[model samples]
Target: MSSRNLPDDKKLIDLQRFQLLVNAITDYAIYMLDTDGRVVSWNAGAQKFKGYTSEEIIGQHFSQFLTPEDQKAGIPALALQTAETEGRYETEGWRVRKDGSYFWANVIIDAIRENGRLLGFAKITRDITDRRKAEEALRLSEQQFRLLVQGVTDYAIYMLDKEGNVSNWNAGAQRIKGYRQEEVVGTHFSRFYTDEDQQDGVPQRALLTARTEGRFEQEGWRVRNDGSKFRAHVVIDPIYNAINEFVGYAKVTRDITEKYKAAIALKQTEQALQQAQKMETIGKLTGGIAHDFNNLLQIISGNLQLLSAEIAGNQRAEKRVTNALAGVRRGAKLASYLLSFGRRQALDPKVVNIGRFVLEMEDMLQRSLGETIEVETILADDLWNTFVDVAQVENALLNLAVNARDAMDSVGKLTIEISNAVLDENYARAHVEVNAGEYVMLAVSDVGSGMPSEVVAQAFEPFFSTKPEGKGTGLGLSMVYGFVKQSGGHANIYSEPGYGTTVKLYFPRSTELENCVVIQTVENIVGGTETILVAEDDEQVRHTAIEMLTALGYKVLHADDAQSALAIIEAGVKIDLLFTDVVMPGPLRSPELARKARELLPDLAVLFTSGYTQNAIVHGGRLDAGVELLGKPYSREALARKIRSVITNSIQR
Candidate 1:
């Protein structure tokens, strides 16, 4: 606009004042870019944001304000193109200043069009670095809080809807409330309060108090799902949204019944027995947590494997991702350890030769322990066969070796011994949990620091660790104990303050001979052009399986449970194979679904998979006779091979 074309002097002065007002603004960068994205005009606000004077910045390309990465990616050109074609463009990203420092910024570019002709672009920028950092920290804090709530086992932590109905329940909630998720969710939370409390409308009062004052806490008797009564320490806190409106309530309760009993015992005795009594509290909770944790790890591993194939360049990034994937596998191992601790894991108790198992693990033990630590194995001749889950035993063995290594510190001797023993009636009487039987004993001894009698007594308790926090989850020995007990055996730890520690696990001797090892010929994992039905309760797993199957030239029909799978099968579609999970929510289990499917199509192929065997298609810790099973965390290759193999078996039959 030319000043000579103005109407009058006063109006021109008013226009000058308006221009001065625009230049006076320092909080927001206001500028104009030519048709080609070169700076055509600048204000004082631009100098405040970019630290560049108008004389120095005019005619320079506006891409100079963007970071090198954005410049290299042609972001400035895209912004201009978008603004010119679509009227405006807005986004948030890192912006560089004249001093070369970067600041997180919010930017907007609008096309200055007249008579449908290209004129210039009006641009604005604002610094939001502090706000961005605050948001990131808040996100991380919320994540940590969520994980902690999910991991709580000592208390029932849950959320209630506005009207006091249970909205969400954690493992601890089910453990303490004695109600499965299906029963408690959507039900009024007052069911747990005593009749007197319910009559007094205690639940409503608590929610009201929390909503008004931000929190409410009390100690009273709460009824279990079985109608039993127990004293509970309860706290209710109002949950609020970002706008400060009340959304719900976070309820946490701890059962102090067993703690009251521990009050009569000595301090150390109470501390040790505290968790042991609480074992009943985690009955179904731990198992479900372990299974879900394993499934999560499987998903992570599967995704990482898939990602590895896609990233061809950048060795540094690939190596970092690979290392992270390895850490995830270690986490998976930990989850496996937890599953054994819960005794919910499916077992394949094959008759294993004790001597052979020990000898096979010797090399691994030696490698795991440094050269300073001496590794010795005592293999008894004619060692009895034991019916045990081989994978669990391997996990237990590795755990024991790691513990021994940690105890040994600089240098020590570790001995692994295998022997056959018979527990008489008298011995079984002393150990009430054990039964008199012929047994195969596996003992690990360490010649290093050992626990005192007090510590030894609580060695098998979960989270009972002498190590510093973050160094241990204290589940290793507990896992060994749970596995041994679940396998119809016993675990005993002998330790002294001065001498050392010897941990022994006794498995009932098996009359059956050692299992025969089968070696199958390797073939390419290629899928057929046949239709297959996939039944899985997890949405992500089900979708991933479908995608992989469809990619492999197979037509996939999927459902979230066994009942839906049955419906698909009874629909009369030609299904070449039934791929299903062992665990589902409905009354129809995988075994029943497969049975019905087989009845419908006698030669129909079936393949089952799970993170842990849920005993649906398994009997006595092993897959049912003539059944084909694939363990979870399966890769595309494993899934392909298993499906092809099952289908081939059906054809041969």
Candidate 2:
């Protein structure tokens, strides 16, 4: 410790060199302490590291450099005890410097003894602040990661033993599996599987696969504690020790019920879109056929009307004419049904007072549903009026009544309620194609045997039926769905097994317009003559139309194609009406021809005819809102009447 204590000569030179080497090291505080614990020597390294000069700290007590807590805990005494008994002591502690700052230090004290007596202690202290900080940071980061994993409520994060036993569970696992940690830990992971899955040994296979292949991934039904099944995406990973020996497994399970539902919904939507496209195509085809057939019907009806007028009081002929008129009406109904399927059902939207509508349906519901079921109406007064096709809405209500009657087996209470609704952003976000606005809510509730969850899910899927074979067509709700959707509304169904079912239809509120009114045309109208242009692709129908028009006394010019018809018009043919089929060849159609012909002859009355009405030309069997058009399969009388009407309407316009 002192210069006088140094031995003389070359071996002492080696010791001096070693001391010089230690003093040059700034990372460690290499110094000497006296037998009584006083700091005897401080090297250049100690001075630089401990913020002290030899003059200031040489005679100070070594405990003075330790933190107060360490000193209070007798850490200095323990160091001295180790130096005495084991000849050295090593430890890490917070040690102070001359500047009153502290750092994490690794300290080693070695007892220096000679000739069976203790002279002093050699001490070495290294700054370990960076290592300590790094360890602390790593520990904190791990804690945060654990918290993040536990906080996930959408996924079940847990661990399993190598034998597929549950070893750990997080909050997320508890929330998803409906189990507390105490109820699930140490149990076999197979408990999460459905009965069928468990019987199939799926859980064992999953673990086996994970152990053999290092990982296993699957998606299927997983049971909850309450016995309900959820669609889940699961992954199991084999955890191994450093020697690659399997220790346990890490299993992550996510309840993908919403995601699965969304996927199914998307698939259904695609199918619906494809079906819609197909229906549109069919509509166009049927419409073309109907258009031609209609011209033929016009010819027949016109001649029959003329004959009926001329042969008045001939009972046999009169009876035949009445039968024909009745047949034509039935045919019109079939065409309308087809149009509804094509979403071309004519929509005559009006601002409807929903309360009044529901009230109006109650008597009909009572009569249709019978006395066994009580019909209740909860009509909210002054509810926002909705722009809707009232006749379609009434039909939809009747359809719902029939559905409820079937569900309830005709013996439960049916509630039809109308109320003002405010559809906010949340509702709009949850239901596609819905917007935030005021709506008129027409809710139908039934206390019945109720539908299964799956049935409720597909309640509005077209052609999806649960009724016994030959009992139902499954188009009732689909039509309701289409009608409501086309009217700018939303529909929702809620049902649970053995409870009841509630269906809500929301139609956007109309700011103006009022009560639905059916437009009336002349009933039992007779035939008339008008110069007409008949454009038809079918030869039989074209020839029939020409004969019918000529017989009816209309100077007729005929063309089989829209192009030829246009050429006739271009050549200054004085056609009073442009009568054409809706679907035509080339780039022109009945509607397009009418536009061109009307330009050529401004006073020309245009009439469109189609077998099965469609969106492009007709809506719900009526002409598109403002278009004066006629549907196909018309009788001779209807044809003549429609021509007269169109011509008369043209005059009025």
Candidate 3:
């Protein structure tokens, strides 16, 4: 058996078996190229992976598989030269397959030299597309999970550096830690513990336990920025970077004082059982109806916008489209009112100098009240910043002005006065359920027919509008009332039937300075020529998107489903961005499709559009972090801006 490694015939048989084994492997495309990098030898595996038969690829250059960008950059030539000179070359990149779609390929090339003379090179490539997609999916999932944890308002969530310095803060963290992100990051996290705990090295012990045991949990008292102490349930989890290197700790602290008291108080009986049942039923009904109605509206409204943009030069058609849009807007407002009355969300409150905000709106108010109305602005000296939802505040002002106009028969004297006000305990007692605090007062008054005492008392009640029948939806003042109360502020209406009406909205003062506000002027619509993939199941909606994007100078590829979209991606059409519907058919959802597409083309951008988010990318009525969402019924400018923004970000990437 060891006689010079067997006879020559036996050796030839062994080599043939080896060749068959190599050619039969389907998972990897194994083959050989000539000295000039031309495909000279091919196998079944190569035929399956490269979408080419031996006859088709035998004389083709191996560089054909490289992406356009790679080929343009001379990567293929360098790969061959490197393999021939350096003995071997190995790397990963996008490789074109038979149908022209791309796949993430792990490739290797070895120089083949016989008798000290260069012959050719042996090349091997494996499709790692699924592997790459899985990794990307995991990354996006982790990011969204982090966003969900950070967006928690009931817990103080933050991070500390390895040395126990605070490095991040969430909204809840700021509310609990009594510090802004600028004040907390880079500071010692030990400040969250009580003085006694710090003295006893609790912070150090916590970090050590988290690092060693994986996590630390305890109940303790923590101090706030106002030098106040509050009981909290705290947990610290050790964070590690890739390769398991120690990074820092994720800290989550929950305020349990009010929660504990509420649990105890409500343990025995449900006082609002009937009321709660009614509201729950209403919410469910409203949600179901809204989803269906909004879906139809999305198709109609979207097409209308496209049509309007297309018929911009036709006078009658343009006028009709404008009227149609107004109707759609009214319907949309009604839908908003229904949702607000059912499952309303919290106000995104910010500290704003109301004085400046009012001044900016003066021109708009003048346009609203017409020339007959005298508008006056009495701004207070040394204006204080108050925390409130700026948009809702503006809406409230506009509502009051309109009501004042209606009361005055479209002509009256309107005054907007801003000043500082204080609410003492006495005032709190007079206004039940109101807390005493220093507030920024925003008062709107009009010398018109005023409301009676009874009418004023019920002004803030839902469905209690005093406007003539067919004039209002009755949600204006009600919305204002809810906004003020939810913001930890107060709204008071004072009126004399014969005199006039004055509404005072008090927003709690804040220590933070006012943030600068930007006023955007109308600008010409921006367009792009980027290639966009539009994946939508609805034909009308898909058509509208294609038309709108095409009108904006973008080249669009349309797909009716996620599978078809992926097919297009796999076939390797050059795509700049993926504009997909968040909710789609089949197992390959939009988010998952995005992951797969990104695997094929890492620089490909993604934008999600939906009529209703339906938990696809929106969490708690807010878009997830790092996600760009364009809600249904968007205009041309909105679409252009979002697409352009995404493409710009991608270019930088």
Q: For each candidate, C-alpha RMSD in Å? A: 36.0, 10.0, 36.8
Better of 1 and 3 by TM-score: 1
lDDT of 2 by residue, 154-261 (tens): 889998887777888899899999999999999998989988998898988998899889889999999999989899999999898899887999999999988997
The TM-score of predicted model 3 comes to 0.49
Return the lDDT, model 1, position 10. 71
Q: lDDT tens digits, residues 1-653, model 3?
A: 86357899988888799899998899989999999999988888788878999999999999899999999999988999999889999998899998999999999999998778999999999999999899889999989977986788888888898998988888888877678889888989888778999999998999999999999999878889888988889899999888999999998899887766555446422533543464456556655566556556667777888788679899999999888887877776666555544434224455799999899999999998899988899998998898766876887889888878877888879999999999998787555556898998889898888999899977876678888899998877766765566566788999998799999999889989876643332356788788999999878778878888898899999999998999999998999999998777787888789889999999998988765555566444435555766756576777877787778777766
* Candidate 1 TM-score versus the reference: 0.53
Q: Estimate each model's TM-score.
A: 0.53, 0.56, 0.49
**Local lDDT at 43 for model 3:** 82
Per-candidate local distance difference test: 0.84, 0.79, 0.81
Model 1 lDDT per residue over 1-653, tens place: 76556779878788789889889999889989999999988899889878999999999999989988898898999999999999999999999999999889999999997878999999999989999999989999988887888788788999998989999887888888889888989989988988999899898899889988889999888999899988788999988899988788899999987765445344545543664456545546765665576667667766776677678597987897789788876786666666667665567677898779879888888888879889999988888899887878988888898898888784899999999999998777556566898999999999878999999988987778888888888999988887887788989999887688999999999988899754242289787899999999988777777877887799999999999999988999999999998878998988899999999999899988787775666565455667777766766778778888888778878
